[model samples]
Structures are given as structure tokens and as C-alpha cells.
Target chain A: MAPLEPWEKVLISADFTQSIHGRAGCVACHRGQQSPDKDTAHVGLIPDPSQDAQRVCGVCHGEIVDGFGTSLHASLQGYRTIVYSRSVPENHPALDTAMQNHCLSCHTTCGDCHISQPKPVGGGLLNGHNVEKTPSMTRVCTACHGSRVGAEYLGKHEGIPGDVHFREGRMNCMACHAGTDLHAAEGDAAKHRYWGDQQPACKDCHAQVGRADDPIPQHTIHGNKLACQVCHAVEYTSCDGCHVAISEKTGNPFFKTEATYLSFVIGHNPWPSRERPYEYVVLRHAPVAPTTFEYYGENLLPNFGLLPTWTYATPHNIQRQTPQNRSCNTCHGNAALFLTADKVKSEELEANRRVIVENIPAAIPIP
Target chain B: MRRVGMLLLILGVGVFLGACASQGISTPTPVPTAPLPEAVLTPLSQTDYCVQCHTDKEALIETAKPEEKAPSESEGVG
Candidate 1:
């Protein structure tokens, strides 16, 4: 995305001036002087007042602001869960510093969604200071999630079509992910996005699935045995061996991935629960290795094998009919489509032992 | 010739009056009202200097500087 012009960043519109938020006056949110002089007016200016959402937005939106502290978007607890599992308490300080430099920038505030683009994308006002109830899918939501989720949903990969929901239904992220889910309540203790009940499950809308008298024979036989993505999802991105370091020359943090390619691999469910109760689910290779945070200190992730490198995945690229579901033989007896012992790296084989399919299902017998 | 000149002058006056009527230009009418106490006039009710300047397109363009690149890094696994 091209960066916005200087004027475009600060320009205010007439519609905003008459809005309920705008009527509160600039100083009500942004604590700045009302003087005509530019320097005098900018004294003690708060560029993003919503950074302190408790005091600023809480006046009107107290309910949301109260629970926002625990939200994944604000707390970034999911990252900590994985990072802590891989490191000892002694190495926390160094790991924290690395995260602060490289990962903390992804943290979002209220203004990041409603008023401006995300900080990662060089935030500018989405619509001349007007507050958007539903953030722009292209500008705000996809700005950070663009690398994999955005690409898969929008079909950026060559020869791959976009998700059927996006291509056919024109449903944006908000269509499935509700605002309440994004602003997860204070007591909600789910560590990872996939840990709890599916926020937007397939069965929520498609109630007809798994019915006894269903028309499709596969629906009855395979519904409980496989995750919907195992058959519905097509090839999606899987990254490997991502390393992060601070540049000595420029003193800026950056990350490099060893490889990123499209693949479709079904493996045993690593985190099977009531919500995701299936023997088989799609897997994607995450961009993490033993030395992922080595820049901070030596062997920061000593227990890296505590978690699998090829984690369970729910790819965004869904299709009504995929190559895997064309017929029983398309996936059955097809060892190439399954993550087996030979498919994994030598070092990671131990970590991913739980997910690797030991016995690929045999081909169906002929009549 | 004198009669023709008289008719032209009358037509000009009629056209001028019609244009003014079309534009809804009428004499101002005064309505009486009591002045409110000074305490009722709050700062929130008025458009402050900040809004006055920011809404002005010309003023913003004149003051805005070239955008500086925001420091960024590659995508991390989430």
C-alpha cells in the first residue's frame, strides 16, 4: 500500500466536524492548546489519545474499554504463551527486550482500528478524522495480517483462487469475526486464538452439516473424523526457519524467513478438544526454530521442542470443491498429502511426532 | 421612438424584480429574543481554533511537511 500524503494524514472533513465524537472538541480527546500558533497549539499534544483509552474513550464507551485490557489485540498473551513455553524464567528479560523491539509494534489501540490505519502500515486517518464503526478491511485489518491470511483470502498466490466466502459472498473479516469476539471480555481466559471454542465455526452458519439424513454421504462419514479445512481448504502458505535480529548499521529490528511456499498437508490434530474434535486437521509450518530469538541471547529457546514447528492450521483459502475432495482416491491412499516421517526435517521430527500421521488411511476396497 | 424606449425601461425593471424573487432575496425580518447569561456559553459549543485550521485544506497543505518513513520490520508468526 502506498503511504498517504502529509496533508492527507491530518486533513479533517466537514462530516467529522458535525459528528458526535467531533462535537466533543479536539482538546477533549487530544490534550493540546487551542492557540492559533502552530508551535503553541501543539504543546503537550497527544497524537493518539486512544492510547490511554481508559481515560479518553472510557467516558462514553466504558464497557468496551474495561474489558479491552485482556483482549488478544491489546495484551498479546498468545505470543507470550508460546515464547514462555520455549524459554526458562532466567532468559525472560532478554526475550522481553527482543519482543519489545520486534513484536510490540503490532499491538493495536482503539484509534488504530476506528480512526487510522495500523501503526505497522504507517498509520494515517482512514477518512479525514471520522470514526469508522467497522474498520476498513483493506486498510486496517489486512495491514498486519497481510503476509499469510490476507494473501490466502485475497488469492495473491499465482494459480490459486480466493476463498469462496470472499470471492463469492463478498464477506469481509467482520462478516464472521464479530466486534465482541475481537474485544474478548475480561474473564475470557483463552491463551491462543484456537484454544477455546471456535469464534466463527463452520457449523454455526451451516447447521445442516453432520445431520443424519444429509444428502452428501461424505458429510456423515467424514464430518466427525476430519476438520472442515482438511478437505475444504486448498494449498496455503507455510513458512520455515524465521530468524529475528537488530541491524547493527541502522539499529532497526528485522526478520528473515528461510522459506515460504504453498502446500496442502493433513496431519493428526495437535490440540484436539470439544470444539476442534477431529483426528485429522490441516498443518502449516510456522516460521520458528531453536535459534529464532538467538539475537537476544544464547539459546533463548532451549526448550523449542516443547511445541511443534508444524502447528495445526486453519487455512483461509476455502473452496466449495477442491482436488482433495474430488473422489475417495484423491486423498485416500495418497501418502503425498499426509505429513509423515519422511516429510518433516530431521531435527523437527521429534517435536512434531504428535502431529505426524503414523498410518495413512488405506485406499477404499473395490466392489 | 420615445414610446419604445419607455417600454424597454419598464421591461428591464420587471426582469430585475423577477430575478430577485427567483433568488428568494427579500427584506430582513427581525424577531425579538432575550439574551442568555454568559455562563451558558460553553467552549464545547463553539468551533475551536484547532478545528477551524484543520478543516481548511489550503492551510493544511501549506503547513504539512514531507512524510517520514515509519520504521518497520518483517511479519512475525502469530
Candidate 2:
């Protein structure tokens, strides 16, 4: 991480005319003590005012705040499903402690995405806490999401160029992923984030891709049978294994994920939808090892194999012409490009059985 | 040997003079230089009060990084 810019450097530098937060007094949201004395004023000051936005921001922007509460950003139910599925009961003392101390820290609050740098990035004011309708991409989104998605989107990993949309069109994340999508959540508790209809789809913006007149024959031929990312996306970094456990030395919980490697594969879609009723989608190996939470207890997750280790993923490193699109042989005869048993770890074979494509078709040129 | 000693003495004297000249120990003309501007610390946010305490928090985080945490006991176990 780079040294933060001196406060003096950004102070009174940027325009705050349009900033909603600029008008609101700091003490209004961050209630503590306010005095000239450092300790007196700082005591009990909310470092992240967004965490308690229900009480703080809701008073002013009721409907927006209400929508934000159930939003995927707030509830993080999708992440909860993944964690709880592989660990002891959510209420387990050790699990609860870790969730509060470590895991939940990654949880986004309003200020995280809007005003200050995310806590994960060592929180500080971005542009003197000048609130924007579209927050700073590096300070806000990439601060937390930097490991994989950020790297792919920004072309920072493995010398890969940025996503074509961003590189060529100069479009930002908010262009496709609407504010409504980030601030709203609809459906039942059982609904995994993938099941949500509001989830961003390529067809939502690029409706021409799979249309009858589209130049790419593969698009119509494959249709919903293949996800857009599978062909259009370049190789992306993937984390093979992860382990979360309490450190014996410090007794404080720690999280570790395996070394990153770049690979792309087409696998069975975990959850199919109307827009993306794909039989095969891009699969990025997750950071979840079989023994991710075993330190908490023995056999905490008896059915670790219930879900594939290679889950459906949307690598944002999109390109108009990927290796797959160049020639039929890139994918047709390439068993390596498909999630097969041999490609996965021996332990994960069972979990990934459904996703593994047994035989790849021989290269056949399109006339 | 006497000639070599004389040469060495002269070389040493020359080197010392060169070193002094490089270091600006002696100048033909002493130019009065203006003092460099000092940095003024300004608040990046309206909440300068908040930053005062948070600066300590940043220092604490930096210290925490060097402290090694134990790796999980059950890693890579079947």
C-alpha cells in the first residue's frame, strides 16, 4: 500500500459544491464528543459512520437508506451462505467471534463506498470526503475487491490488459451495474445472490451480442448454453484454497488463502437463470479449501462436497477477441479449457463431478 | 621508495582538496539562498479532530503487520 497523501495536499483542493455529505456536519452522523482536545473529541467517534447509517443517514434519506439495508452490500447474505455452508453453525462461539472480528470487517458500509477509503485500505478521506454519485473506483471498489476482480478489471495482474469495455469504451462499473442494483435487494433469504434477477447481465446492456444478425456465429449457436465470460474473458487469477482459523500463538482469528494462479475454464453453472440459462459458465477456482473452517471443530461441514470448488464466476477481464474466439481449436479440442476431473485437486473431484466435462469435441472449422 | 612516498603524499593532499571542493566547504562567492518552504499540515476532511486519533490507529496497524500469526494446525489435512 502506498503512503496516503498528506492531509494538507488535498485540503480545500477539490470542489464540494455537489457533495451531499459536505453540507451535513461531521458530528451529525459521527456522534461522540467534539472538543479541541484530541482525546476528548476522538473518544467513541464512529470511524465509519456508514455502519450505523440506519440511525444516522436514514433520518434524512429514508427510502434510499431502507433500500440500502436489504441491499447485497449491507446484508452480505451471499457471502454468509458460502461461509456458513462450510463451517459450524453461525452461532458457534468461535465462528461468531471470527465473523465479527475478521470476516465482517470486509462488509461494506455507506461511508466505505462513498466518502472515506474502505477500512480494508486503511480508511482515510478521499478528496476531503467529497461524496460523489459514482465513488472513486480505486479508493472505494478496488480497495476491498482488489484481489481478483479489481486486478482483472484494471489489467493489473499477469500483464493482462484492462477489460475491453473500460479500455476502449471508457465505461465505468456503474455504467452496467446500476446504483439501484447496489442499493436494492429483492427476493427471499434462501435466494443466493446469483438467484437474484437484478444481478447484472451482459444482455441488459449489450443486447446485440446474441441477436440473429450478430456477426459471431458462435454466439447464436451456443446461446444461453455458454456464459459470455467463458469466451470473451481472458485468463484471470484464481485462488485454489483458503483456511480460516484461530492462531494458536495470538489466539486471534486469522484468514489465509492459497497462492494465486491464472487459469480459465468452462464449467456447469451453479445457478441457472432466464437471461443466463447457461449450461456452462466460466469457473474460477475459489479460495475455499475443504478444511476451510475445520479448525473450529471436527466435521463442521460434513458436506463440503455439496458445492463445486470451481463455482461460476464472472471475470471482468473482458475482450472483444479472446483466444477462444480466434479459432475453433482454442476451445473445441481443448479439454484443458473445460473443467475436467484431471484438472481439479484429487479431494475436490467429487464436489466438482457435475461440472467436469468428460470429453471435448474435436476441432471442427465453422464454414 | 622515497619518490613513491612523495607522490602518495601529493595524491592524498589533492584528494582531500577535491573532496572539500565537492562538499562546497569553500566557495568563491557565497550566494545568499532563500529558506525552503516548510510543509503545512492541513485537514483532508472537515473532521480534522477525527484524523488526530485515527493517525494513532494507522501506526498500530503498521506494527501489527510484523507480528507473525500462527498458521492453521489443520491446513492441507485430508
Candidate 3:
């Protein structure tokens, strides 16, 4: 980029008023921090990306700062925790510099933890602490992941149900779960809320099984865990009963019964085991996988990564994750999984081999 | 001698006719019915078409050559 004319540079700097007032301009925070300066304020202000903001972020995010002081992450910061532990004979092998890569990033500056920010560094009174007024916070994520996959996950809840509107009547990733709804009062305050555990599992939202929209009342009544896949079989897409045979006389048009194999539902997301639901949706068709807690039946929890982010925050971090169980059952109450078919279907076993047709729902379009 | 011979011939003819009366005649085997349409590929749900249609439009909107965007994911067509 060519150097800006002096007057033009001043004009651009003036335009960033909000950054000036709300976040303050770079030197106010960096105060003599800029390099090669003969000025005295520059000494401690030299911001180090490899180390904590010498001017801690606690100056803002006060609650987080206070919380961090006691956090697992804070313990590391306070010398209570140390990185590069392989040299220490007492330390476990699992912990090394790479371990710092995991915990440090979650609690530190984006540049230090994730990707580096674009230059012209937006230095203001805040020095380098990011106010994140960028029109697209997603740019930060994309710098790390690239525009495709990371772009999809960047926007809050934008990836949810609306995403499903495109394909094969798929469900949105966020529709069955809670999403980041925008209300001016709770902007960044709710940033970590939507992606966290507060977001429900697909089963929890659609646990009531009946017609596509209605929950099975009988199943709910008996307190049976209503895993949707139970009655729904995976093998044959559509069943045939009439033993269809082609007519000898009417040879003009071919006549015969037919069915197809569905790899999508059958193998979409594999079950932790069999004896689970037959008819299922792995991504969203709730039954085969967990919908709620009883689906858990007193199992241990899943990792913080598996549950929504909010579940792991603060006092919520009660459960420890186990290997087998995942998704919602790792956190919330188990309702749908306990229900039975008779309790669900509202009658005795229905006849099989009867060819049937189901109306699939439509997905939303987001340009 | 001629009368005896005539009587034997009549009895032989009657025995042959009687044997023919006891059972039915032979016939050809019947054929099987024609088979149904093979179901290797299922007709896609409308939701699937929604994906295809939008995907095409999105491709056009983003790049006339979506193949360029994710060369590995889609067809190489421009």
C-alpha cells in the first residue's frame, strides 16, 4: 500500500471516534509503548503477543478477570500453572508446551491464542486490547480456518436451523437448540452463551414423537424414554405388502413393487451401540441418538467440548465427561429415551409390509 | 378261428380305450411375473432439491465457477 497523504491520515483517524471514546486510542493504553520511541512512557507498554497483555485485559472484562484469578486458566497465569513441563520429573507426559496451546488460548488474547490481527493494528488509547468493533468478528475465525468451514460457524446461530433449509429437508444445526439472538442490550455479553450447553440437543427439542410435528403423548405419559428411532426401521426406505406382480396382459407399462436403501438415516451418525432406535436422524432426526437425559440412564458426562460452551462456564462445571455418552444426555434431564413403542404409538403393534409414504418438511433459504 | 381272432381284436381295442380313460393329458409349464423397478437410487426428497437448487444459485452468486471455490467438493464445470 502506498503511504497515505498526511491530511488523509488525520481524516481517517478522526473518523474512528467510537474507537477513540469507547475503547480509547492506542497510545492511551500503550502509553509510550510504540517501539523505537525515545519517550519514557514506552518502557512497560511494549505489548508482547507471546506473554499476557502487560496491561491486563482485567482493566475491562472485570468479572472475567476476577473469575479468572481463581480459574484453572488463572492458576497457570499465577505461576500456579506452568507450561513446558516435560523437563519436570514430577509432571505427567500428557502435559507439555502443546497443553499450553489448549488452555492458554481459551483465556488469552486472540492474537496470542488464535490468529494474529491485520496490521495498522488499530492502536488507540486501549493500546492493543481488541474492542472487536469489526463489522465482522467472523473475520477473526476465518483467518484461522479459511472462508469456507469456519465462515459457516462464525456467526452466532446463523449456522443453526437456517443452514438446514438447503439440503434434503435437513434440520438447521441451531433450530433444535438455543441460538445467539441479537438484542441490543446483550451483545458481546451473550457471545459465549449460544454455542455453550444452553443449546439443546436435537432430541431434546423434538423429543415428543408422533406425527412429524406432534410429540407422542402416550410415550410421554408412561414416562418411557421416547427415543425417536425406536419404531422407525433403517433397512428398507419404504415397505411393500401386496407382493406386487406384473400383469401378463398389461405389458405396455411395467408394474412392480419397489423400495430403496437409505444410507443417510441408517449410517448418518452411528449409535454408541445397537438396541437403540431403528428409525433415526443423526444430525437432527433425534431418536437413534440422545434426545434427553433418561436416554442417559445415570451415565457419566461428556467433555466440555461436546456439551454447549455455556455448560462449562463458572459453577456449571460440575460433571466430568465420560467416553461413551455424548451430546445432550451428558448434561440435561433424560425424558424421551425412557418411553416405549406401545406407550408411543397409542395402540398395539401395527401390521408390517404395508407400503407407506411420508411427507418430509422443507428447509429455509439464507442467501 | 376267424371268430376267435375278431373277438381278441375287440378286447384289445376296449383295453386300450379303458387305459386312456383313467388319466389326463400333458400340458406346458407357466411363466413367472415381471420384476419391479430396481431401487438402487432413491428419488430425492424435495429438501434435497432445495439444496441442489440453492447450491447452484449460491455457486453462481459466489463464483461462476464453483469448482474453483471447492475444486474437490463439486464438479469441475465452469
lDDT tens readout by residue for model 2, A1-29: 46364442223223452256654555677
Off by over 4 Å in 2: A5-20, A86-94, A188-191, A248-251, A365-367, B1-78
**Which stretches in model 3 have alpha-carbon errors above 4 Å?**
A1-12, A17-25, A33-43, A48-57, A68-94, A101-107, A110-130, A133-137, A145-162, A165-367, B1-78
lDDT for A345 in candidate 3 is 22
For candidate 3, lDDT tens digit of each residue in A215-332? 5443343232323332221111211111112234642212122321111111111222232332222211111111111111222112111321001111110112221124333212
Better of 1 and 3 by lDDT: 1
In model 1 chain A, which range of ten residues has the least summed lDDT? A184-193
lDDT of 3 at A124: 18
* Model 3 chain B weakest 10-residue run by lDDT: B69-78
For all candidates in order, the CA lDDT equals: 0.88, 0.72, 0.28
Q: What is the TM-score of chain A alone in each candidate?
A: 0.97, 0.90, 0.33
lDDT of 3 at A77: 41
Give the TM-scores of the predictions, in the order they appear. Answer: 0.88, 0.77, 0.29
- Show pairs that collide, candidate 2: none
Question: Candidate 1's C-alpha lDDT?
Answer: 0.88
Give the C-alpha lDDT of model 2. 0.72
Candidate with best DockQ: 1
Interface RMSD of 1: 3.1
Error of 3 at A90 (Å): 4.6
Best by lDDT: 1
Error of 2 at A43 (Å): 3.7
